[model samples]
Target chain A: MISFQKFRIYINKCFIALICLFSFVVLLPFLMLIARLVKSGLKYICLDFFTQTSPSPVDAMLANLAGEAIPGGILNGICGSLYMLTIALVLTVPLGILTGIYLYENRGKKFANLIQYLNAVCYGMPSIIIGIVVYVSVVKSFHSYSVLAGGIALSISMLPKIIRTTRETLKLLPAYLKESGLALGGSYTGVILKIIMPAAKGGLLTGILISVSRALGETVPLIVTALGCSMINWNINAPASSMTLLIWDFFNTPNMVSMVWATSAFLFSIIICLNLIAKRIGRQWKFILYHE
Target chain B: MNKNHILELKSVSISYSPGSYALKNISVSIKPNAITSIIGASGSGKSALLRSINRMHELYPNIRMQGEILLGGKNIMEMNPVEVRRRIGLVFQQPNPFPTMNIYQNVLSGYKLNKIYLSKSEKDRIVEECLRNVSLWDEVKNGLNKNPLSLTVGQQQRLCIARTLALQPEFLLMDEPTSTVDMFCTNRIEELIYRLKNNHTILIVTHNLAQASRISDYALYLEKGELIEYDKSNIIFVAPNDKRTEKYITEQVE
Candidate 1:
């Protein structure tokens, strides 16, 4: 019996080691990607990279001949990205949260179940397809690529994710908490705003942050809708450029290929920061409720 | 409608689905400023009856409630649900303090929910009085800003009671309030419930027969969703009119 126990322990140790090895293997690619991006991208990420517009192909080739770094930065891309993101977030946040609340409240109903099914389909739908749909609907209708079209497409892509998170977070809370609020003689709106919303804020914040990062990383839809502007464009009706668009532009142009790495690295850093903040908030809020 | 009784249920029947009934024609009159314990085995619909009083039955899907529940002569079935709920408070089996709220906020949650603006002094007075009424003021006086979740289960339960009591409703409905607390906390809560009867009419659903007999002025014994006996606690415990009540009491005593 003692010998059998010893054998079992040995097997358990081996299993744990194998599991750890596999988990590390899963994380290895992410680490390598970051390492490569940092190595190739660091040189061009100077003050000019952030403050100046993208260098023209001729200008970049001239700089290359002189063994100089690219003269212009991705300041246009940064502004355009921020502008479209602001529009997308403003459109998506309230709409997503409200839809999520509706789905949660009416769960098990046929209409809610159907909407949930549609939302899941939308969530898994290819971004390229969404890009095409927005292109035809918004860009084609207006006869011009516009920041508004890009914002609308990003909001569409973000809606399903935000709805799912809001619903799931609300579902995780005990039913009695809402009931307790209602029992206090508060209206449904009052209970939801004061009791349910406050309790779910942390989870909601994490979800919204994740969605924001996901939206920021979006490329295909913005490609079809925004169409990538060369100069800084303030007019909503004019074509705008984002970080992903800049990366795409550089990747296509031979002389500007090196700028792609720097732009990708910048985008990656912002997403990492968002994810870290989400993780911190998620950890803090996870312990506050449902302890019982 | 009895003029003496503060709340009356006339043939109140609650069904979760189309055909089946969770509570069958439960008609009971409750006196003001008294502790009435609804005692029954599991699945006896004690909770359903308690919830129906405050329109909480409407929370469930396909839940149908028949018959009139009269609160102070006004038919609650016809009254606005928010108004009915405000006039009567319901505590659940588990302590459910608003997780994001501090002790002081939890106490004042009812008022906040109702949008009744209270000045700083008024807010302070209400929170202190409610917490003290539940005998939790001394234990948590210094930590009013601390999360209510940080408190022990018993303390959290009291905080929940204080939250409900902030509205100063005429009626309090508690479903297994002490079921999750320790014996010491249970004793404290029982004493508090007994004292609360001086100001508010209280209806409590409990599985503990001993608790029912000890704290209640009037006891209601239910079996299979039917009221088997309803009388003064002494008479019901010592000499129940129904054979089922006696059998249940003897079995529990064993």
Candidate 2:
């Protein structure tokens, strides 16, 4: 039997080895999926892939060696997604941040306490539930699944994230900052806007970016609400389809599996680009915060 | 020293919660342009006493108080907290210049508090003049737009002093302003305090008796939340009226 002291050392070593294995296990699925996607999607990338969107398996994909004309462009899906996402962001970011600030700044007030509890509950709720609520409340009234309904649902789901992140980011700010502003005769709003927000700008930006990313990737709400048409609708007043629905619809199709892979790759790349951009912007924001 | 008694506290007593006396009934008159030092051991209510002048005591919760803190012949309790604070500038022990602001912005914080529309030139002039008063003009002149934290501790403390001065307050409350600074900063701030004494009524809280003797015109000793003694700084150092003051001086001297 090993002595306790030696056993402790052995345990430490085993812990480190376990961490390595766990990391690999965690990464395995993603790596495998990405690797498979890259390999499968390589043959699909071409001038036709760029110019044409909905390629029939019998046309562009099946007649791989034989050149054939493809119909449609992801242009509609792109436009619809861009349009709805913009509306969702416009609806969510400002309202979410303002609510977050209210919760944090007015902390300990009965209203603030209520808001805190509600925000917490909202954050924990499943996005699907929000989607269904939006569907029943807004979509049903319109008597059809619409992009506006989808966007409203997306905005609702994004709201809790934005509020949670904004609240946490505001909390991360130094307590002395508000005190300093207060000491200087600054009003409560002035202190939050001019001092606290500026100090926590980096963290707040990161939080907002996370919320945006979460909104961008959401599909369940869009599926149940927008029901996702293939055509691009510029006006948020009208029905719209987005990339997530395209990915979902294509992946399920027996004949259109190739197009699904391409769209999947596109969406995955977009998310990565977004994350990188957010990371880069966050770093810059922090630099400005500390050294402005 | 300036002859006007700019601020006064009459029988000011504060408690953190119910029946927890942080400061006992303490009466003191702050003279204009004179550096008055509040000296005591830690938890002796020196900081609390200083905070009461600018209504900083209300910054916490469940803390109750009874006091008539007068500013320039008016009880500040009758005025708005913002109004009282605007008239009395405070410098903390630590050099806490706003990190998000540039050197120039920190000096103009007081004006920004009013949210008054100021011409860019007027704002710039205030920043330059205030920084100049604290003798931080040259070191930070080339970098007015640069962040405040990039400056040395000595420069930061001076910047804080400059920040305080920008409010155009008649009195200044410094809570151990030199304790966190180095000797160079200490000397620099002491000199600045000396220069400031001709204009603003200054109340400083510190455990450093020598510092009290060095910069303060009036020295006050407090113990167990009670006023032990008050006299001219030199007299307090050489021939203190209280045995406790004498013991404090002896301990510091050793």
Candidate 3:
């Protein structure tokens, strides 16, 4: 009976090892794809890759046929992404933070619970579904897919993340801080804005950074709203391009494979850089404000 | 409504629910320029009674308080809570100086919160005076920019006192201010409270009978939400009063 128990333990160990191996195997292809993309993507990157607009698909195809490389860069896509993200952040951050504070302050109230439930549902909703909704509401109403519509879509997706993070961060602060503030003759709004919010600044900033990174990489929403342009377009009411959209547009074509890889590498680097910078600043901010 | 009384509580009771009372029908008058200590065992409503002075009990949604608390002959319930708190400050059991603020900022936090603007020199003077009153000025004067958390527990408690004093409050309510600190720190804080009573009416809630004997001019002994004795501190300590107060002081029924 003891020997049988030993065999059962040994079998369990083997199953665990097999599961680990299976997970690694599933992850291996993604690792290799990233490696290959980095290698080919670095070869195509140049100063003009950020400074010049992407060529038309036909122009790019003709250039490839003539034994020339793709003639233009992804400046329009980069600019468009930045524009939409800025608009989205402007639209979403204040509203999200205020809602978060409201939820925290009015925690046990029915209205707060309702807002929390709605936020959870919004957070769990698929990116494509948000895209389709935005397409119908904004794109159709405007009679054209525009960057403004794209921004509205990204803002909706980013709001729940910012709101949740802000609420959680504020809640994690000790109750004594608020009590002390109130005891010092501060109005409720004054205490929240001055003491509680300042204490949670690092967490709020980190949340915004994560939200921005997520918005930057989103493609599905833009596809239905902005509808991808090759030329640089600054008008919010006109079609625009973003890095993700460019990658999506190029990846399926036979000759634009290198462009897709290059764009992917660029986008990945930006997102990683943003996250790292945010973490570093957050640490520094806490050290400056709260270090003992 | 005696002129000497800085604060008066008349038949005040606090209940968190319909049927249970945390503090039951307690009435007391606090004299100005003196330290009055509320002494009781744990769960005896000392803290609840102290909180009612500044209306701190109102912050909790579940708490229900009845009757009147008057500050200087005016009913505090009719006044704005924020304004009432400005005149009657509170110090909690724990030494909670704002972790995000430096010592200088923490001291001036009251003024900043109340929007009582001062020129830079006036601000410096208030900080110095308040810190000196707490006897923490010499230790912390050089490190005004340091985080409040960098200070020892004793210094942190003193810093909180200074923060309260910076607002020029008429009455200071302390709920077990020395309960979390060392014996030495407690002695220092007790001394500061003794000195502060010359300018401010101070109400302290303490579990330590010895501390109440050491610092308080008047003693208010409570038992099971009832005011069992209110007398001069020396009398309350040395003489017999209510059997419960005597029993608690003797540690026979603690």
- Highest lDDT against the true fold, candidate: 1
* lDDT (Cα, 0-100) at A16 in candidate 3: 100
Model 3 clash pairs are none
How well does chain A score by TM in each candidate?
Answer: 0.95, 0.86, 0.89
Best candidate (score: DockQ): 1
Q: Could you give me the TM-score of model 1 versus the true structure?
A: 0.96
Clashes of each: 1, 0, 0
How close is every model to the real structure, measured as TM-score? 0.96, 0.91, 0.94
Q: Kindly list the per-residue Cα lDDT of model 1 for residues B1-254, writing each as its tens digit.
A: 23634899898888888888888888888867889999888898899899989999888868999999998788987889998988899988899898888899899989989999999999999999999999999999999999888899999999999999989888899999999999999999999999998888999999898999999989998888788888999999899999999999999999
- lDDT per residue as tens, model 3, A1-292: 9999999999999999999999999999989978987898978898878889987778788989998878789999999999899889999999999999999989999999999999999998899999999999999999999999999999999999999989987876778999999999998888988888888888899889988999999999899999999888889899998999999888866689779888888898888898998898678666655562
Comparing 2 with 3 on lDDT, the higher-scoring candidate is 3
Which residue pairs collide, candidate 2? Answer: none
Question: Candidate 1 has which clashing residue pairs, if any?
Answer: A52-A73
Q: After best superposition, candidate 3 residue A60: deviation in angstroms?
A: 2.0
- Model 1 local distance difference test score: 0.91
- Candidate 1 interface RMSD to the true structure: 1.2
Ten consecutive residues with minimal summed lDDT in candidate 2 chain B? B1-10
lDDT value, residue A140 of candidate 2: 86
